[model samples]
Target: MVWTVMPDFEGYDEACSQFIWDLPASYNPAVDFLRKHENSDRVALEQAYPDGRREQYTFRELDELSDRLAVGLADLGVEAGDRVAVVVPQKPQNPITHLANWKLGAVSVPLTVLFGTDALRYRLDDAGVAVAVIDPTVRDDIDAVRDDCPALEHVIEIETNAPAGDVHAFEDVLTAPEHTDIEPYESTPDTDTAILYTSGSTGPPKGVRHSHALWLGRAAAAYNFFDQGLGPEATVWTPADWAWGAALGGTLFATWHHGGTIVGYPASGFEADEAFDLLAEFDVTRSFMPATALRLLMEVEDPTAAYDLAIETFAVGGESLTPEIVDWIAETFDSVTINEFYGQTELNLVVANNSNWFDTRPGSMGKPLPGYDLAILDPDAADRGVAERLPTGELGEIALRPHDRSVFFDEYWHMPEKTAAKEVEGWFVTGDLARQDDDGYVWFKSRKDDVIITSGYRVGPMEVESAILEHPDVVQAGVIGVPDDTRGEIIKAYVEAAEDAPAHETLREAIQSVVREHLAEYEYPREIEFADALPQTTSGKIRRKALQEWDAQGSVDEESP
Candidate 1:
């Protein structure tokens, strides 16, 4: 399990200055989040279903289940280094599959249930997954693409009494007569654990292979963001699907790793009222929620007025958020800490805000978490084959030095050329743009490709959208650069207006005024179009590329959601 070295228990600055990573040579993710907690009577998990059914498992029960499943998988010809894919909701099978696979020293490939045929086929085939444990909801999608995946030999459906051709029932596998006798495979900090694909906001998705040390790398940042220390008293939860990296590492693994209780629900759709009910029922102390989920919660005129909430801390990441929304989240709950972090699939949870450490900066992603060396690098230097840091106030690409390999991914799976491109002069370059202030806070801009070139000035869509969202009538905003002969590229905004709000020139001019007042004159949107809704990624990030295509073709983009 995980433990914070807080024996001194002083302030944030002192802890960071004196902090150092103390990692063991050999480590296993399963041992840390599951196996090590064996035979304990403390409850480790809670699954609340929609039908008024509830299931709670103690640490001992989970460890024994993991043991039996490991043996069962071995009997199914699964061996060390095999790739096992998991596609399910927030159900018991999700964690069981991961724990069991790691016990056999296998790699897990998480796939979202919302993916279409092509999206599903590409990842499964690219990773060459041998076995898949999935919920019944996605059976047809997997069956439709099974023949295309040559390496995929077995499918274990979660709970289907009918047992179709070439598929094994999950219950049958777990109930087989083999006792829990197999020893967990020995693993080190360098042993492979998982392969999470990039969201591909700009291009096709690639598999990012990571080692078991991922949990170690995320420990400090998560601990600080969760308000410093967690123990059996902590109960954490999140609405994100199990397929996403933020939930898998930050919530599911981090909670158990810290000897805390984790709560989940098999929700097909996230109803804001239901979400609040679950939180109140479980007395969840901490959570990692996306900005989109928070926006939906805003629908409730008053949350505490409707339900009792025991939320202590909420960590937001996996998408961009407006400063207004972050502030609203804080004021909505009494005595709740809201922290925003910045990271992608390659390097997860490196930068974050710790309210106890320092006050929340409205628009800035806080200083680097302990154990990381972060910098703002010149975007053009990478193309010229060197890594150079930019001036403190100048905008540049955010990059991380390889000070410790435990926290970084090993490589992009099976793509050596692409992997090589990720590093330049010993720094793992993140293509997102940002700037550091004299106070050491980093403010996010836009993606490198999402930057707009207007006349001789460069602008980030994030800054513009944050300004536009300040208007009371605007519920959502997405900014992009469209082609213009006079200025080369003119800023455009796609907005979702409130029901009572007018979508005429009056509202457009008002939004433009807000942008002009908040940022430089050239950064305001030249044109605005109001839509019923904006297309977004599964994690709640606005798909600006989709907005660009929609503006180009003058129609909705059906290819991505």
Candidate 2:
């Protein structure tokens, strides 16, 4: 698929001459996009499974299936604002359920398979989910707690042969009704569309409710700014789960909203070679993956040998992109851009590397995306994290004044107190610290809570992590601060060494030496611990909170942090 790259933000409409944004009053992203390109030659999805089973669908067919699924759901008593919980891997059925919920004006809450019974039950009860679509493999845990979930009325198993008690086969629902009798419900765009939950370090996960306007508005801005190169004919791959804000808002919704195609490689397993082969076979134009997968790909002496598909935009998030990974992509695939953006589940891409801007700044999460107002506030100021807003070329906590509140995450679902805690007046405190250069580019410093304060000096973990990654023996690293009597908190390093390197005290000292030489003495890690592998969430991010907990519990007894 050929792409017409926009020369500037002003030329976005010209590059995609047929670009149109006409959202209904109750603008569900699925229904809105399906209505526009129901008859167009737009490919809605292309799935290639591990066993070689492949399937493709046009926009019109996807719309029809969603309609049928909606009719079936309505028959099951799902009403407007009702919650439909889906726990499935990356499959076409996932998208089907998403649109089906939108068609009925209900909320589609996608739960990742990584969560166990406890997490699942919390979400099921918290969101007041009535209908649940669980994959047969992971449905056992859900069934165990099904009795306790009072709001849960129906449990539909995806591909299970055994039909236990109240559980119904997923295929039965799809085939029950081809009826187009389902009427479109009138929904206010500002009403709650989804309830996304996010996990915390201390307690259970918190649900974040997002409205239809927030979903579409974030999609529109991201569609216009970050992905100007994608055409309506392009196919994109996002390794992230749809549960993630970046994937759901940035890739999934934005792609369909802009009338583009979404391609999938729904492999439940992680195989670097097989993943590379699939990339080559599909000729995927745009793909979003985490840095760890990209790092593994770079380990291949010549990445082009396994997969030589034309990658337009190689984007990554959920973790900071190291200089080595960024430099490798630029040196190997010069045409493909390796860009990083800053955001959380609460908001979409508030800052990103614009497509037309060829300038790539390693360690920097680019400037604010177009149509966003950002300010870096001093930490000592009265705003708790953001003291006073800093001017251009200053360092402070990165805060944003969203142009439209409706386009942001509605609020922490049922956690009004926590939502009120995050919102300082009107500006959303991102909990991140950054410094802007003279060119208006924002450089990530650290998370406000994650920052280490020693001897009244502030230290950013990313800078130290990047420095440690440069060491020849180190493969991955997660840095944090532990209670220190001398200093307020001392920097500690958790290192994942190269496969051949010995996990010994000597290596720990050597790692410390490297950090000390590369960065400031205070910035160097005072304590170091080696690990076989770092604990990460399903999204491939090192869970620093879990590591910190392990330190407190003394469970990781191998070495001291």
Backbone clash pairs in model 2 (N, Cα, C under 3 Å; residues 3+ apart or in different chains), count? 2
Q: What's every prediction's RMSD, in angstroms?
A: 2.0, 3.8
Q: Which stretches in model 2 have alpha-carbon errors above 4 Å? A: 1-26, 38-41, 175-177, 201-203, 224-227, 379-387, 391-394, 557-561
Tens-digit lDDT string for candidate 1 (1-561): 244332343666776677776666778777787656544778889989999999999877787788888887888999999999999888888888899999899999998887877888899999999999988888888999999999998899987876788899887778453588767779987889999998877888889999888877665567778886566788988999888888888778877877788897978887889999999999999988887687778778888888888898888886665676667777787878888888778886888877878878878888887767888999999766689899999999999864577678889989899889888888889898999999889999889888899998999998898888788888789999999999999999998888889756889999999999999999999999888889876666788888988998886554443
Cα lDDT for residue 416, candidate 2: 83
Candidates in order, TM-scores: namely: 0.95, 0.91
lDDT of 2 by residue, 274-326 (tens): 76776777777777777777877776767676567767777777777778887
User: What's the lDDT for residue 237 in model 1?
Assistant: 89
Clashes of each: 0, 2
